[model samples]
Target chain A: MNAAPSASKEEKNAMSSMETPDAELVARVREGDRNAFRKLVERHRERIYRVALGMLRNPDDAMDAVQEVFIRVHGRLTDFKGESAFGTWLVRVTVNYCIDRQRRQKTWDARFVVDNEWEGVSEESPEHQLVNAQIGEALQRALAELGEEHRTAIMLREVNGLAYEEIAEVMGCPKGTVMSRLHHARKKLQVALRPFLEEAGERDLADRAGEGVRRRE
Target chain B: MNDQDQEKLSLFLDGALAPEDAAEVARLVATDPEWKAAHRALKLSGEMMRAPVEQAARSANFDGLWAGIEGRLPAPERAPSLLERLRAFLTPPVLVGLAAAAAAAAYVATRPAPTPAPASPSPGLAATPRIAPAPESALAAAPADASEPVVIEGIESEGSKTVLVSQPVEPGGTTVIWLLDAPDAAGDGAAAPTTDDDPI
Candidate 1:
């Protein structure tokens, strides 16, 4: 009986030590540990920034979403009763903030030029960097033209790689809604990028055949 | 493919259709040229988006983004956070002691220190307030108007000062009153209840 009590106590301690940094930091943060809070922020910032980029498409808006996520997380740390995993909560907050920003932007002019357009290479180097930039810009433009719900759903699924259930949770909707949105988003993207895709494919075939002939020679 | 067939094919290309439905769509797309072309386009778009943008946008000034977000956030109130509230709640004795020391220091500052009270006959036995029992007469004397209802009644004797006392009760209504006989005019009350407060 004595050994059993000691064993259980040691087991509890071991489990606690293995707890995630977010929960550990939360406990310490409640005790006013600033260092612990900084650690938590550092762990999540990059992933949060990536999620923001997927949703907003604009680097500036995405970066804003990232910073806001950390601040809001810090401010509301105490209210985190640990009901959900910290990453799950952070993803939800990041997605919601970007969507809210998108909603607000819509109220203004539709012609707001979101420069998802990145810098392109000159005609002098039209092969590697240029093609990549052209494809990126085309993809960004096509994505921007999608409706808000479709865009976010596609971004979460394809870009962020969140599960359908996780996407549903983040979008504050049902799994069926997530599936429908993703389906529609995929359809819209196919229509928007069809011309570019066909061109890319023709180019790919020509390049492959050229490479094959050169090898034979 | 008709619109409905086209829509189902699109979803299938992205792997968003249910398992059984997806199997059906896959069979159709494999055998049907038009459906195959449409699926190819959908698959291509998804793949293109999944590809990295190759380089980080040089125009993305993360510092500026941080500043903008900070500007928009309602500046935190200068007041302390909930953590501060909890710290204060936990250290009631420390605060009470500090307050008493401050009051004494202020009085001493105004008057003169009496040569440190001759070094206190015993250096180890520094003064600490104790809950002296209320005289029997005080409890027994029950105000002649006891019939009028005792507004606040409590056990003020033997280690039960107001700081250590529980809430008072009456026939009806509530009145906030402490159980202390009187503040120790000479010293400050330091040792108070640590656990008894949980009762009421």
Candidate 2:
């Protein structure tokens, strides 16, 4: 068997900054360390949840997908050859599980398709919370209208901040395919969200005008 | 505008375009109203799509997720079957060997037996032969040998055949079934090979 590749100097520095490196955690898990597995979950659960939510849409479904993903990860942990970053592998699992679940349901018209709901806004100002909720809802609605492949690409690119190549790997497609999917997805989202953007722009303009009046007074 | 222009604009929006191409797009966006509109829309859409992940921490159910995952985990020290042990040694390439062996075994096991025809056919006609599937109970009760690999074969549908092979690997680890395209099954594109080591 080939030796696991050594972490580069920059990678070592980055992992040193963290409480425990993912590779170390994975190694421990492989050796039957449940605590290490839990730690890995603690570190990556939020991002996994977000990716699940992006693909599955419904909060309950997303949560279920998150659980299924980790379970599959645990079952297949031994097979993880450490060929890629743990986060990349985990994200791939999450995306594939969500896609499978979505296919099973086969619902095209479902609402609440992706991301966090307008439940908890930590903003102190009620106005800010309301605006955020509105924008969030609008964005979710627009995302729901996209095709599965398009939505997956957009989520990987925009939400997870994966590079084109990483997105390609996660989606199991070529870089060019990823770009094309993102382009089409973005175009569709823009068309769907133009009204919301215009409204938000108007609201911003009105808010600025009110501030100007207060300053004048 | 055109497909090429749109793709270029998309690349520009994603910052994937080369510096020269980006500059060209920037000029177009500056000089062309349509390109500017498209750019603004794509930019806004990208921002909204990105917002969810940035704010994901605020909405994630971390405690619940951990609880769910922890509850479903199997015991780490649970003993695995001997077949499971053999599977660990069988890598992706070895999967094809197992598949071929399983197919050959299946053909030998399920091959039809010829019998002498009756002296005279019935007045009406000969009856068509029907193949019955193996009983589930029999399959379940059958004991698998630890020394030799086990092969199970059946038809999944009209045109598709399924063969399952269990082989031993190292030890302690559970059996993992790695499905691969059979050598003779290539170019059919019916079933894609998948292994636990590789992400599907």
The best candidate in terms of lDDT: 2
Candidate 2 colliding pairs: A57-A113, A57-A114, B84-B175, B85-B168, B85-B169, B86-B168, B86-B169, B87-B168, B87-B169
Q: Write one digit per residue (lDDT tens) for candidate 2, span A104-190.
A: 877643344233433344654787666656656666676777888888898777666678888887878898899889888877776
Model 2 regions lying over 4 Å from their true place: A1-14, A17-19, A108-110, A113-142, A194-217, B52-56, B78-200
Residue lDDT tens for model 1, A86-160: 877889888878778878877312121223232333344457445555555556566777788788887777766
Structural similarity of chain A in candidate 1, as TM-score: 0.73
True contacts kept of 1: 0.31
Candidate 1: regions farther than 4 A off: A1-21, A78-81, A107-138, A206-217, B2-36, B52-200
In model 2, what lDDT does residue B101 have? 96
True interface contacts reproduced, per candidate:
0.31, 0.48
Using all chains and alpha carbons, the TM-scores for the candidates as numbered come to 0.53, 0.56
